[model samples]
Target: MIKAVHGDITKLQGVSYICNAANGIGPMGGGVAAAIRKAGGKEIETEAIKVCKEQNPMPGDLYVTHAGTLPFQGIIHLVTMKQPAGPTSYDVVRTCLHNLVAYCRKQGIDKVALPALGTGVGNLDKAKVAAIFKEVLEPVKDIEFIVADIDQDFIALFA
Candidate 1:
């Protein structure tokens, strides 16, 4: 079953992959990207760039790359925003998660990890964000979802 948890993104146990809230260019930006880079190293950045080049992912599009140095088996980086740079919104969050599920299904994966998609730099409202996720995800029963919100209030919304 899909579950919500509050924890460090770097230390998620058992899940094979995590979603990176990346930009169109696909570099490791701040927040979750920074934390993943700190644990996984720059090779992750290089691999993401390679995939980003081929995909040119816009908001809601999904890109896949090997985890590089991440402890996880692979990374499914979602471009949650357009190039100008900044916090993502509810639209970005909702679409990114859909893209993520599609990619996960393609790869024969049933369980995955995610950070709160547009909340950090995106500055999206927590209640709205949680509601959007629950709405989109409440119906997809093919796979199990695990999203980690860095903040506590978001966790309550999901709980």
Candidate 2:
């Protein structure tokens, strides 16, 4: 079942993994990445950098790493933008969700906590972003997808 809730993603429960809205280079600089790094520890950023060096993820790509001290088993860093200041496209968001779902299936992760991709710093429209997620993930079975945020506007989209 796919559900939307108002809460902190870092403190999410019963999810196998959580996603970070990251850049292509994988620095946990600000916004969602910063929050995850602050809660999960610096090691999360370090491991993400290692994966970034190896994979050199581009926009619309994804890299996975251990969740560090966070409760979840893994952190799926979704690269929604190449640069922090760059504008995000709908295709980029769609691709990121697509890659995330594929990775979850491969890792046998049955549940995931996802933030509003590109909405924090990228300043994308919340409803549009939410719709994109619904489009990409609605058909996938078995995986419990949770679109989490503290913002009422964001949570209302899922409702």
Candidate 3:
């Protein structure tokens, strides 16, 4: 089942993973990344850097790391853009959602918490990003997905 809720992703419970809208270079600088890093602790960033060193994921790619001190078991960091210079394309957002679902299935994670990808730091359209999420995720029946965000506009799209 897919649900839209307004709350902090870091505080969400009963989720196996939380999706972080990350840059390709692995810095938790601003927006969701900053919030997650603050709540999940420095280990989250450390693990993410390790993954970046190993995988060097590009835009639209994803990398997973231990959730560190957070409640969830893992953090799935989606590289929403190659850099923070400009907005990401719809295709990049779509690819991130696809990759997230695939990773969840492979890891046997039944529940996930995700923020609005590409909407914050990426400057993509919230409704468009939400629509893409619904397009890609609504078809999958197995995983329990939560689109968690403090932004009313973003949450309203899913609602």
Candidate 4:
């Protein structure tokens, strides 16, 4: 099941993994990623950097890391761009969603909190990103996805 919510994704309850619209280089410095780091702790970023060193994940790849102080199983860093603050495209977002669903199915992740992908520093339009999410994820039947954002326009797309 999927639903839209207006709030901070970092503060969402019952979700073990919250999707971070991350850059490939690994730094949770801005936007929702920053908020999550602040709440979860610097350890989360440290783990992310370690993963980057090991795998150097590209756009559309889902990198899993420890949640630090946050009360959850893990954090899913959705690499949307190659570097921090770089732009991302709709196609990348689609690939990320597709990979996320596959990863969730393979890893048994049932619930997730996801924010608007590539709408921040990536500069993609919220509605278009939302459409891509719906296109790639609407067919998914097992995962309980919460498409969350503070922006009403983004949430309205899911509604």
- Model 3 RMSD vs true structure: 1.2
lDDT string for model 2 (47-83, tens) is 8888888899999999888998898888888999877
Off by over 4 Å in 1: none
lDDT of 3 by residue, 54-123 (tens): 8888988999888777878788998888665456888998998899889889989988999998888677
Report, for every candidate in turn, its global Cα lDDT versus the true structure. 0.79, 0.87, 0.86, 0.89
What are the per-residue Cα lDDT tens digits for candidate 1 across 37-129?
778888888877777788788888878767766678887777878663665677778888777777878888888888777777777888898
Model 2, which residues run further than 4 Å from truth? Answer: none
TM-score of each: 0.91, 0.95, 0.95, 0.97
TM-score winner between candidates 3 and 4: 4
lDDT measured at residue 25 in model 2 versus the true structure, 0 to 100: 77
- TM-score between model 2 and native: 0.95
lDDT of 4 by residue, 24-91 (tens): 87889999889889999998998898899899999988899988888889999999998999878899
Using lDDT as the yardstick, the better of models 3 and 4 is 4
Of the two candidates 1 and 3, the one with more favorable lDDT, higher being better, is: 3
For model 3, how many clashes?
0
Model 2, residue pairs in steric clash: none
